[model samples]
Target: MPLSEQEQRLLDEMERHLLHNDADVVSAPSGDRTLSYRNLVYGALLLLAGVGALVAGVILGDVWGIVVGVIGFAAMLAGVMFAVTPVRRATPVTPREATSAKRQDSASFMDRMNDRWDRRQDGR
Candidate 1:
């Protein structure tokens, strides 16, 4: 359900107050839990290599074949582990904070302009 304008305003105000009072609330870091696409691809490659090695090992029936098969299986297991691990990312900067910064800069510029105007008027 969509929030009404008054509810939205209240939420915004509460957020501003909370952010002002709590630095952790504003700057808290977040973590990304999804595995990256690159990691997925790597995992797939490892699995395929392991399967191929195992198949070749069965067909060749040699010591080197068994060794290669074991290595490939280990690689595939490592890839699976990597793919399952959660990735960490920092919390995103809020649009409200950015807008506030821009407004402050504009206000400062306007104050300077007003000061200059007052100085000129006083001189005249």
Candidate 2:
């Protein structure tokens, strides 16, 4: 069955609201840290080397092979950790500044959402 006019209108409004809010979420700051391209590249290189070592170890087989494989595994683990870990900002964000900044950003957003909810509940 097709949606009634009121239902369609509500759906449209919901879509608009979702799109607007989604833009905010997408653009929101990720905090005082970021990933480095240099780190990523180095990590990838390390990971590749680890894989090669692992394969070489497998082919060699024996006590030494086991040691090489373990080392390779550790290298791979380190590479992954290095790649994903975010670097801290040079200047640290003060707790008060962080809280105030976050509150200022989110307060308006929450208020808007609350107003919308109120309007919606009131059948406006």
- Candidate that would win on lDDT: 2
Among all windows of 10 consecutive residues in model 1, the one with the lowest summed lDDT is 26-35
Candidate 1 lDDT by residue in tens digits, 1-124: 9999977865665565555557566554343443467777777787787778777777777898888778777877877876666565445446576657555455555575589799999995
Prediction 2 TM-score vs. true: 0.51
- For each candidate, the alpha-carbon lDDT, in order, equals 0.67, 0.74
- Tens digit per residue, CA lDDT, model 2, 37-109: 8889989899998998898789889998999998998889889888877776777545464345444455555
User: What TM-score do all the candidates reach, one by one?
Assistant: 0.44, 0.51
Report the error of model 1 at residue 92, Å: 5.5
lDDT of 2 at 3: 100
Q: What stretches of model 2 exceed 4 Å from their correct place?
A: 1-29, 90-124
